[model samples]
Target: MATKYAMLARTSRLQSVASTEELEEATTELQNFTVAAGTLIKVASEQSAPTDDLQVFVYDPVLREPNTTRKYQCAQDSLLPVSDDLWPFIVSIPEPNRRLQLVQDSSRCNWLYTAMPGDVVSVPARYFDRDDFRLFECIICYIGPVPEIHPVGYFFGLELLDDVQSPQTADISFTRKYFECDADAAIFITADRILPTPLPQDEEIESANEAPESSWSLTNFIQNTVDSIRASLPL
Candidate 1:
């Protein structure tokens, strides 16, 4: 379960900044949020074609100046805001809408819930299965078969509240191994809240090496990864 502290706590806060001004508003909120330890952040988005570039800048508000910002080729996709992944909570772009997209699951034959733009979603780090590489694929790639349109990309992070024992850490590492088998197929992370990035044709070799150990090829990997990740989360 997520630890929800009283808003009064000076170091426990969460907010979503949709604009520069909104980001400024997060200052006070950040003060209240006690950066939780053992946080794992999974940010996924598509990269536009090479001809088109996407720019994202991060400001260290405390300094009133920007830090070393990164610019990726339109075809490049790397984890943005590569700051500490864990936090007591999150302050992200877009906001949450109570509404969810409903889709029929052919395998399960049940309606499942998915995130719309502005949805700040969370899941336990333990819920991910590293073996099938399904978890990693879903988090990093959206090429899976699911037909539902994701209004925006997804950003997720976990804040570990208590002392995690060695077994739990082992389990997490064990889960990561399943993902290591593919090691390629364009598994990349983006900083945007919406899906605008695209995998570059030039990076094809880099991506291919990242596929999972399972029977998934690039096509299956995309559909399966997107569908699986969208389905696995608790909506």
Candidate 2:
């Protein structure tokens, strides 16, 4: 059986900036500060809307314990306003659309039930076992032997946020392993309330087997023809 996981990380403060340029400047400054503090910085989104500038969420990997000293220092150094209410959190849910029930000893936060656009969720990568990879691929890409139009080319991040042990933190080695394995367990942003695509029945699989075989044969034939032509025209 496939296991799903969820994590929550509190946002200590929300810094509102005047413009996009200022937001970028603030993000860069925070990134540099993390680097100076010997911590890895994980930026959730590359593009930010004007409203997103209302809160700049920074995940600090170095500070494992829940201490406000460094967080305060970082906020002070960056000159960003810190919100008194630290209830807002970024929650990562593995399976979407399913009602998330609180597990015993599990981490909790304010936005545990709601999913935001920039929220990072984990899914098994393509490098996993054939069945597991196909399961996720069918759900995420939606191009598994179906003639109907489906979404594709969704990007994933090669880093797993470890919020269980330490809230809103990830180890450098843990993040590196994803890239090393060609992204064994990559994280993706939830564009909407995503749900897993149902697996095809046995009869459906039997019918689709021939298509793949034909496709493979045609690909091999093209490659062989190219090789033959190259051999004949050898200098």
Candidate 3:
């Protein structure tokens, strides 16, 4: 988020002159004191008004003057103050976000993420095959397939958060890193698998209500993932 700011001229400060009677007496030079250069300040808009003289809390901390805010007159010299553009505001412009766009499943069904990147969700099985693992929560760190790999995109690049380990670490090599994580913490997978698994707590509820069936032993997990990738492609 961009904060509103006012930039002061670096070379100058508030200029002062002697009294009106002294101004009538002196004809040549004006008396002044050296002051610090201008400061870029951030302030609460409610405390200030957009006028020629703007009141703001500048970094002008003084030894005796404890109160912080000060009012100063400013003009750009580019135009007349009455005709100048004042009180303008910045607005956010809309852009396309792929996560909001629909993704197709292995069976050509459409789906969307219930939890986005940086949020945890359970996948039926992760990238590699190891018998003891089943549904577990992994944070979705990315939303596209591995680069230069087949079926161009539509995979979740995950950062495995559980005690269970995997061979991947966002990439196979240093030059190909897709996301940052520990050396063996990442795995990329299709969106299809995230839908079928229940989170561990949800799994416990399922076990309490019904006979516990074997979640994917996934001896063929890699092959299954590959098949899903191919199935998602146009024939």
lDDT of each: 0.27, 0.30, 0.42
Error of 2 at 21 (Å): 34
Ranking of predictions according to lDDT: 3, 2, 1
**Local accuracy of candidate 1 as per-residue lDDT tens digits, 1-235:** 0221111111212222244554577554322122222122222223345533233223233331223332212112222222222111122212211010101112111101232222222223333344422122133322111112122332321212233322234223322232331322212221221222235676977888776566656888699899999999999
Write down the TM-score of every candidate. Answer: 0.15, 0.19, 0.32
- State the displacement of the C-alpha of residue 176, model 3, in Å, after optimal TM-score superposition: 7.3
| Model 3 accuracy (lDDT, Cα) | 0.42
RMSD to the true structure for each prediction, in A, is 23.3, 19.8, 22.0
Provide backbone clash counts, one per model. 34, 0, 0
Model 3: which residue pairs collide?
A: none
1 or 2: which has the higher lDDT?
2
Report lDDT (Cα) of residue 111, candidate 3: 25
Best lDDT goes to which candidate? 3
Measured with C-alpha atoms, the lDDT of residue 57 in candidate 2 is 32
Clashes of 3: 0
Q: Could you tell which candidate, 2 or 3, scores higher by TM-score?
A: 3
